[model samples]
Target: MIGYMYILQCSDGSYYTGSTKDLERRLQQHQSGDGANHTKKRQPVTLVYYEKYDRIDTAFYREKQVQGWSRAKKEVLIRGEVDELHRLSECQNDTHWLERYSSAFGCAQASNIIKKERKKDN
Candidate 1:
């Protein structure tokens, strides 16, 4: 099943990141204050970025990676500046970025797809 990693820019200007099998329903939940506790309190968030994955685990892992990012890094993601994200993530051990995500997000196996793709052709 296809799943999505999404970024929401909240009414209060804070950002929230999450993953779900249904992006529309999740967004609606957040808008209606039935989403995550963080977003529920923030109330009325606008979806600003999303990435689709073939597996729910992949999406969930990406969500965790983005959640730990700085606002500027998230903004770069929202703006589609993938190079910037790479630059930011690469500053570490080149693996820490994704490692932290895989460990925290409970989808290490699925996230390997993204890392593999990155190692290919680019």
Candidate 2:
């Protein structure tokens, strides 16, 4: 069945992300202090954003993903800044393989070196 992934802005200004088959009922529960402990403790939350999904699992998955996101990334989603999501998704200190190799030699030169290494191995 269809389900919803939703984000709520708590009275404390924190965000809560969750998924449910019944958005209205779930929201009511949160407002009434009968929801998850996190929301119950931070009562009086306002629905900030939501996305509908064809499958309950999909909604749940999205909710988990959103819950793990940083505040800035979440804000990007709330503001409907789709283009900024990718850039925001990147971890500041984490480096990709290409980035690590390219840091010493420029990107184009690093790429050529990697290609040469691969050819040598083959």
Candidate 3:
């Protein structure tokens, strides 16, 4: 089964990150106010980004990683700004492989697609 990590951009301009086995159902719950407390008050969030994982642990860990990020970092993730995301993931000092895992993911691609559509909308 595919587990997923998702990010929601709430009406208040805040972001929520979470992992769930059922992406569609989980999103429904969030929209229906059956989601977490943070989201319940925010009411009416829009799904901005998501990543599917083969393992639940992977999805959970990714959700945590995103949750710990600063708002700008999360925006980079949400916008699918691959170049910026890689820069953010890189080590400030000289160190290889700091962003290896993150860079390998296709998040950048998805982000880019979303970015374009949003541009067309505007």
Q: Rate the local accuracy (lDDT) of all candidates.
A: 0.85, 0.91, 0.84
Candidate 3 on 1-122: residue-level lDDT in tens?
67899999888989999999999999999999999888999989999999999998999999998899889899988888989988887665312332443366456654565557569979
**In candidate 2, what are the lDDT values of residues 1-122, reduced to their tens digit?**
99999999999999999999999999999999999999999989999999999999999999999999999999999999998998887654424646877998989887787778779979
lDDT of 1 by residue, 1-122 (tens): 99999899888999999999999998999999889889998878899989999999999999888888899899988998889878877755436656766776656663775577678949
lDDT of 2 at 26: 97
Which of the predicted structures, 2 or 3, would earn the higher TM-score when compared with the native? 2
TM-score of each: 0.71, 0.78, 0.72
Cα deviation of 73, candidate 2, in Å: 0.5
Query: 11 in model 1: Cα distance from truth in Å?
Result: 0.9
What's the number of clashes in each of the models? 0, 0, 1
| Candidate with maximal lDDT | 2
Clashing pairs in 3: 80-111
